[model samples]
Target: MRKIMTNKTSKYILLLICSMSLLSCEKFLDKQPNDMLNLDQVFSIRLETERYLANVYSYIPDPLVCNGVNYTPLSDEADWVFNWPHQQINTGNWSPVNTPYDIWSKYYKGIRAASTFINRVSECKECDELNPGITVQYREEARVLRAFYYFLLIRQYGPVTILPDVPLAIDAPLSEMQLPRNSYDECVDFIVSELDKAQQVLPDKQSNTREYGRTSAGMARALKARVLLYAASPLWNGNTDYADFKNKDGKQLVNQVYDQNKWRKAAEAAKSVIDKMPEGLYKKNGTDGKFDPFLSYQYVFLDRWNTEVIWARPMTGDAVRWERCSAPRQINGYIGLGPSQQLVDEYEMENGMSPFTAASTTANPVINPASGYTETGFSTTATKFTKAGIHNMYVGREPRFYATVGFNGMDWVYKGADGKTIIRVELFSTGKDGYNGSNDHSTTGYTTVKYVHPESDVRNGRHVLKSWIFFRLAEFYLNYAEALNEYDPQNPDIYKYINLIRERGGIPSLPEGLNQDQIRERIRHERRIELALEEHRFWDVKRWKIAEQTDAAPIYGMNVTTGTSFSDQNFYKRKITESRTFQKKHFLWPVPQYEIERNTELVQNPEW
Candidate 1:
């Protein structure tokens, strides 16, 4: 839960830049501001140009909204871990006002900045501006940044404008600025065009280590693939959820039938990135000779230079710390988000079959082998369960879960008040430290342990200062598998891409001769499990129009009580909500209600 901001002085300067436009003539569309020197004066300084580029990264999650705290309703779906109050809400109501809105706003702010910078810099008469090589690179960087923002908007809103240039007015009237939403197809074309422009000027990711988190040719290609995949999804292509577009004034923008070939284009884009990217998975610490292709996923998020991350947003200053924020409330803080049983079940068993779908296996029976529960623990357990559903549910599921979630009765280690490393018992049973039952000091029941530093490095702000990964190499592989399976029936390589992920997760490979639909289903399952709680699921559901399939079910949360030990109880068996969905009007967020009122040219999305 870190917030990365541009330096205060630079932000003030940007405010000045925006403010100066106000004092000048209203018709000064391309005019330079008076307080700041002409573009030539600013562009002459090397640091000034770089500083403007750096401002694009200034937008990131506010600490309060990061993984540490779960106020957003989307967290209830899959992209985040939620506990307590969050666990009890109707996740379907995740509206424009949710965390998605905040993320959208910040991304657009960057897009606006980049667009302005690109326009101004291209016109500058300075030597830096005259240098076509660097200028082209800078221009592509701005386009790539703008493409990223468009992708975010499209993924969340379905159909959005592709504003290649900054709007002339900060508060332009809707009538004066009236622009219809582009067709999703047109949006995809615009994004791909921007990426194509970016690839020409962007350096290969391997060219520079210092700028490791910067967007690269690989990032641009990978993102284009992702945009196409969403457009080609069953929800968008075959589903009826996003067949129409509406604006704030109840106006239709553009509409077109979704096509399956978008998947083919998506697959091709993914292939382009895979063939070029120089990054690989970050490995885990292991003892035996078995090479775990899968390492601790936390490494990608917590390790800045982690090879898998293609583009990232680094966290520094006070934002570097995530321990107290992500730790449990019982550890003397707010109770962090808890992983729901929904996600816990999504990860396939070691054998690669959902426990719900698996044929009764004698080794891992539905009933607990021990004398804790009374009925078959699989299907029957959900209805009349006591202790944790199936021991195997916790047993050998995946290594990532252990690294990500702190489970019942695990040792919580940290430097105690004596400045010495102390291991405290976190679950119900008492061993070395007496079990603390209070949520205030310890709902640290399943406190998140992923981002915390090792005991030896337990200084107040000693957490890893890694960049927040926006996209990783593995995701590109998954995107390829997903798109190919959907678009190309003749290709057998689809299974190969998916199996790579399955092999890493310790899940079994797919049975031979499965149809494309079967393979597609498997890929979706893999993505949900592999990318759990990383801000992907909510968009996945929205784009796939499976918000109904994925979101229709009421969210459930484990019912843990204070002072009562759930060691012998199925503490997680509790019904929270009934169902969730986007109302026809809720599909695209109403261009925030205030914005519509402020800018007459700006139309709101259908129903507010």
Candidate 2:
């Protein structure tokens, strides 16, 4: 299956190249009706039809790369050291006209391509003859892909223009192309209905590795669950902020009324996926039959197509670049990606007690004495996870903390000049990976180890190649717990699923008899830790309508500029690294100014 997809991908690339060459030649040659003729030729051939379907699959965003679809750096979870377009977002330097990380045009282009494929795939009689039901599956794939693109568009831009299933022709009138934005609920309903139609025809899972990244019934259901979950969130549900936001015809782009049943719908949607898949959370057990939480949590991203993964891109984009940017300077890496102190503080102690009782911005963090967490002093003794003399701030934390964070003195498993050796990361000013007035250093005084394989040796140019998972089983568990807690806090299923993740992270389960608010906070915290750096934090905060408190707040890290050595206590002191901005308008990114200019009928988001 992998070989077949690879061949198809190559053919698609060749097709694109030929298309581009023909486009250039069209400038010199007489204009004819060749566009339709070429498209007709493409759909009439079996292999060419398959290649076109592969091209539609190519638009699935690359989550591994920070500059593209991944929104990690735009949130409080992590920071990218170099100046990328996403970095400007935190500073409130972007606007509708000057939008950074603008995926509006890119996704709409994909939608048009998918729509065209869906409408024309049946024309390929040769495709059905080659593989009896292949064309039917191909049409379903294209349908779901179109729905997925709409999902992405709404996720980023809130309300968007929902194009018809049949794409507009090249000769379509300009006035006909200018369409108004659909109401938020209408858009959601359309996407959900389309997904349902595709889900009925698509198989539960891809039969072969060749179709690994392609859409399946599971992907459609999982995507539906996410879309419904977002629709149920506070930002979209009863969000009065968008009350005045309407189109030229006074059609409400955002629903003004709140609905509690949306949460139930979200829960049911998530449960549907849970009840269907036999796959569980990916775990690594020791030979003694004991679950190794550290390895289990670490390897979930490193291992390709693990039991936890539901959907992943077959071709990983710039994954090695992600590792190179994450690796320390001592090992010939850029060392730019840094985790925030707020995320570090969110991790529970070995006993499952949160370290900070208050928010991260409190002058003196009210530490949890029962959790045995201390910000000052160094550990005199080594535990199973850390070395002796490591800062108390990093010692005796959860297994996930060890797996995700690269604190000062943490052992980084790497292949050295001779062979594999353990290199302790030095993140002080004078240390190897420390902030040395270069842009390639970690601004937060710490680096990230998540999604970075242990054997990845940047210095030797050897890196691991793995799919960037878009949807996973663990996310559904978190989603289920969150939605259930909102409308059915008393339901025991909430604790059951949340505890499943906690147990996998080597932490104790939640104590019984917690209130609705308490359970909600715990569930949100679980998502923060469990799905860290997986591109959920950014949207999670937005949908929950808490970005003003989290994203706009001052983000902190260790004093990277003042540290003299690895053991310098001044280096360990917490300090603000970046101050961000999040206005009410930030809940949904503004429709690109160019888009608004092109279509006067389109309405910009509120306060853009």
What Cα-based lDDT does every candidate model obtain?
0.55, 0.82
Per-prediction TM-score: 0.77, 0.93
- Let me know the TM-score candidate 1 reaches against the reference structure: 0.77
Model 1 weakest 10-residue run by lDDT: 16-25
Candidate 2: pairs in clash: 1-210
Residue-by-residue lDDT tens digits, candidate 1, 233-295 = 764565544334445555544444667777888889888877775444555564675565344
Q: What digit string (tens of lDDT, one per residue) describes model 2 on residues 100-204? A: 878899889889988888888899898666555667777888888888989989998898999977888889999999999998899899989988898888877
Regions more than 4 Å wrong, model 1: 1-41, 60-105, 123-132, 164-176, 238-255, 278-280, 285-290, 293-298, 318-321, 329-335, 358-392, 413-447, 452-459, 570-584
Judged by whole-model lDDT over C-alpha atoms, candidate 2 comes out at: 0.82
Candidate 2, which segments miss by more than 4 Å at Cα?
Answer: 1-37, 287-289, 315-317, 359-363, 416-418
TM-score of 2: 0.93
